[model samples]
Target chain A: MKTIKSLHARHHELSDTHHQLEVLNSEIFTRHYLPTFREKLKTSGLLPLKPTGIEVFQMNVGYMCNQTCKHCHVDAGPDRTEVMTKETMKQCLEVIINHTIKSVDITGGAPEMNPDFRWFIEELRKEYSGEIIVRCNLTIILANGKYLDLPDFYKKHNIRVVSSLPFYNADKTDRQRGEGVFAKSIEALKMLNKAGFGKQDTGLILDLVYNPSGAFLPAEQSLLEADFKRELKDHFDIEFNNLLSITNLPISRFLDYLIETDNYEDYMEELVLAYNPKAAEGVMCRNTISVDHAGNLYDCDFNQMLKLQIESKAGTHISEFDLESLNERNIVINQHCFGCTAGAGSGCQGTTT
Target chain B: MQKTYYDPADLKKFGDIAEYGQDLADKFFNWYNDVFKDGALSSREKCLIALAVSHAIQCPYCIDAYTSDSIKRGASEEQMMEAVHVAGAIRGGASLVHGVQMMNKAKKMLM
Candidate 1:
């Protein structure tokens, strides 16, 4: 099942890459994609780092999401069985209690899907006393009976909600998120806004995520945010705090989409050529510690997918997390890194520029 | 369909590698800076060519970065499209050339 599943993911990738050359050649995509932005430049080694403290810790609760967006890198779906267990959540909380970690970022297919999510949040509220970030799909809250009041719940706890709304246009959003998702998401956003999620001075923080619909990194986050803010306000009457432009890493379902579509070569070449050292200076993996549902620690979610164990060697799981020891862990890396460091750079929060 | 398995999204993991030892990342890094340097090619020229080469080697990160870079450098839509085509030709040629090996085998068998 694992191999077959990986194969399915691989097929999606081939599809994305294949689209450029349906027939023999004369492909425009590859040529436009490579030789990189680095040619005619210099290359440097040993990426620099500026520590941000273990002030923030983010967890991927599971792979179950309400919307199976086409470009979703997680490949999360209704059947994925990888949600973090409540026990694991406790382990995470233990770290919060013991460490100076100031914030917690929770993400997943719809991190809200985890059965004990509400309970977990309550635990954090009562115990951690730090900022909480919830990366929501928005539509999940409207998925069914149990989730209907999540927006209000989030507001009561003062959790920061970072929602994904790919585009302002219904067709584009639906195309990416799933049929009718655009409307449902907008409705959910309304619930959030009513609770002052994106309102002025409410301190109910609401940030939106904007990832490219195709095989490209997003434009400047500031520029894209301005456009998104303008468009969403004008059309859907939607208002959010900020837009984080993430350069989608080549992994999981998104990787499969690229390969399945034949967008592989050209896209990789583009990333290589545009290899901006400036972007590399701030790749999120340098500072972020990604905790999987099972308590296994990874440098970032991308490294998690490849199962590249962190170099700390104190051991892999969260049970072994010595904040000091975890700090000692050497973040695993690979060629896929160019994506994060290529442009202005990408991270869970937004461009790291 | 011979089935190609390249993932451009992989390009997103841009700086995580040590290509050709440590120098790979370092060299690429310096070249990247040079490309953006205010000189003959302009960042736009560097972007298009990078995009083209990205196709030749097929790095998704490169593809993603250069695609954005080209647009930022003020490359016309048509020009970017044409650059991709240029890459397609080289890739196709590389692939079909293997047909010569097949042809050689077939002729030798017939002879």
Candidate 2:
């Protein structure tokens, strides 16, 4: 009875609030919502801020991959034919040398699947000599006869490999990936470890990536990493450096999935209600540039999917890169940005601030 | 007998917002299969995060779906609890930061 009464009273309160908001919104404009005015008025505020240094260079070598993961904002897959040529990589080297960039992060469907994959890595090593990261889908190491030597190759360059092992179990792993993927992933991780990938102070920097298979943000990094460590140790004897819990952005294949499944509204509402300015302030776009397969630049990879192109052509086609224009470019954002600016925040490299 | 499913009431305010509310809910359901598409993160892992997030902001529907999802994702009792703690810390920090509002208000009145 009390619950019913309270609910009824709550309905009355909401109705009253809605009526007041409607009046205020009508009096103001056709907005029907007044809170959004602050956003429109943001430039008037003197909360002076500056962009963080581009310490990480997230370079997209291509969209080719050995596996097709659903949450992939990159939409990379084995069927993808996009590959960055050597000339484009050379241009990236030029930007790294000319700019304040300090690290090189190479990502793809399976960054290792490109025919020029080895050459690209070799060239990057010769030119930059800075921190170089490869986002490896561990199973790629065992995908086919062609990729069998990747574990060894990665160790040769002392590459900091950030791979994905969604969970330590077989059923869940297979459910997200495909059949027999969990066993192969375990085999792949063991191979990487033998090649000194995730061993302590072996200095190979083997981190794991974690993302929810549904419509919510990721859990915190430390706790999830701990659980992963314990589970992998007890069961499959897998070890790693860290677990990166990334929030799934609502765009592209993901947007299509949400609409098809009917969880779009609740998920978006959840994200908006959980909006955290600290997360916003520390969003990765403040530092990184996401390059597409064609070499067009975006503030972050997520924005790239939404077609939010950088104001200026920083690196147009590997053939024509303008560092001056790249540095002067303004980052684009949209409502989907709420994904990054919520809770503890998320990014490719893991938690931000 | 499941507690905390989806409530349109909580989401009514987000009705017209781009990429959220009803459409996003629908989108989430469709995207469920896509999210599990072969890649780095597991479907179960994704479900665990979804469920924890549901609890973090008190989304009953998400909580219900993700509770079953966490289990289906093969998340152990311990693992699920750990994810909850992660959400706990962030949500806690979020509230504590907003204490700034109370602090500023107090300072203004006192000073």
Best by TM-score: 1
Compute DockQ for each candidate against the true complex. Answer: 0.09, 0.05
- Candidate 2, residues A1-24: lDDT per residue as tens digits? 000111112343322323323332
The candidates' interface RMSDs, in order, read: 4.0, 5.2
**Residue A225 C-alpha lDDT in model 1:** 82
**Please, what are the lDDT tens digits per residue for candidate 1 over residues A251-276?**
65666567778876656666666676
Candidate 2 lDDT over residue span B1-111, tens digit each:
537654545444343444556777777666766875536976567777776787798776566667755753446667788888878988999999999999999999995
Query: Residue A187: error of model 2 in Å?
Result: 0.9
For all candidates, what are the clash counts? 94, 38
Query: Which stretch of 10 consecutive residues in model 1 chain B shows the poorest summed lDDT?
Result: B1-10
- Evaluate chain B of model 1: give its TM-score: 0.66
Task: Output the lDDT of residue A75, model 1.
Answer: 69
For model 1, the chain A TM-score is 0.87
